[model samples]
Target: MYIPELYKNENAEEIKSFIKTNSFGILVNQTQGKLWGTHIPLELETNLQGKEVLFGHISKENPQGESFTDNNEVLSIFNGPHSYISSSWYDHENVPTWNYIAVHVYGKIRIIEGEELLFAMKKLVDKYEATSKNPVKIENLSAETMRQINGITAFEIEITDIQAVHKLSQNRDDKNHNTIISELEERKDNNSQAIADAMKKQRS
Candidate 1:
């Protein structure tokens, strides 16, 4: 995450909120001298010891899971909305660029099993199901369904560092910034609209 000073977001609360909203992230680690990445939903949490950590799991069959040994460090990347900005949006001639938000978390990975795995899984399920019309609880699952856990490996990553980037054209002047937002909103796509909204919020 090479964030320029102008784009770097140092606000802890905003970064935490971004991670929670964009919990589905890419977990990267080295396996057999080669890098492997897994896409998964990671829950940001505070362990009993009061240390910040991430909880997630992957299928036992996933080769990436092997990298969790020896408390190896890992990188988790969370991405938010992004869109291309046309140079024409700016009043003065300038090169086109992009606007987006992203976060990178570095941590030490440790495999978790037994009750800890089950508890982590329960929390993950409960969080996602909260918005469902007919919510399902992990405890309500049948023994056979619960047996599926045997095929997966759960782990926790104790966070050591977090880097957040919010590249929302902060370098531009007020007129150009507002124009960029207007153009993005007119694009009518989710990413464009999201970037526009974020720009508006940043200004407010």
Candidate 2:
């Protein structure tokens, strides 16, 4: 999250969009004697304060969830598109560099169970299926199915701070930047290709 001025992303809407696209992030928390991290998908929401909030769940047996208490702070990292920009791409004799985008959200978690968890489940089902031709509504599901799904531990992170970095050769000369992007566009890797597209969009 230590983003240099050249790499910092100050666009609030872009940061939110990054989180939406890369919602599957590592949730890190420190407790008692150890620190733990779990990679899971999350639903983003706006809190009453109009701040980013993360809602996710874990298995009841996952001790990682119980650590979120009165004292623990949490951090979730959302890594977007990335690529390696070889020094060869640059016209000068500079070291190789990496071009990437990443966002980190810091907050405190409030663990929810029972009814709150149930509501979260219903919301998620609606979120994904609402746009489908045949929507699968959680509310209409059988009680047994609902019970099975809501048995896990659910939680929400009230995001207090966010840091984003988009190092897309912004500091480089136009020629070098174009060279790196052109190479990425020709690659087979979708991630790199996507990065190239995003960089091109930013440039325009």
Model 2: per-residue Cα lDDT over 134-199, one tens digit each: 999877888887777655778888888999998887887788889988888888698889889888
C-alpha root-mean-square deviation, candidate 2: 2.1
Point out where model 2 deviates above 4 Å.
47-52, 130-134
Over 4 Å off, model 1: none
Native-to-model Cα distance after best TM-score fit, residue 106 in candidate 2, in Å = 0.3
lDDT of all the models against the reference? Answer: 0.91, 0.81
Candidate number with greatest TM-score: 1
> Per-residue CA lDDT of candidate 1, range 81-169, in tens?
99999998888888989899999999899999887788788889999999999999999999999999999989999899999999999
User: Which pairs clash inside model 1?
Assistant: none
Worst 10 residues of 2 by lDDT: 44-53
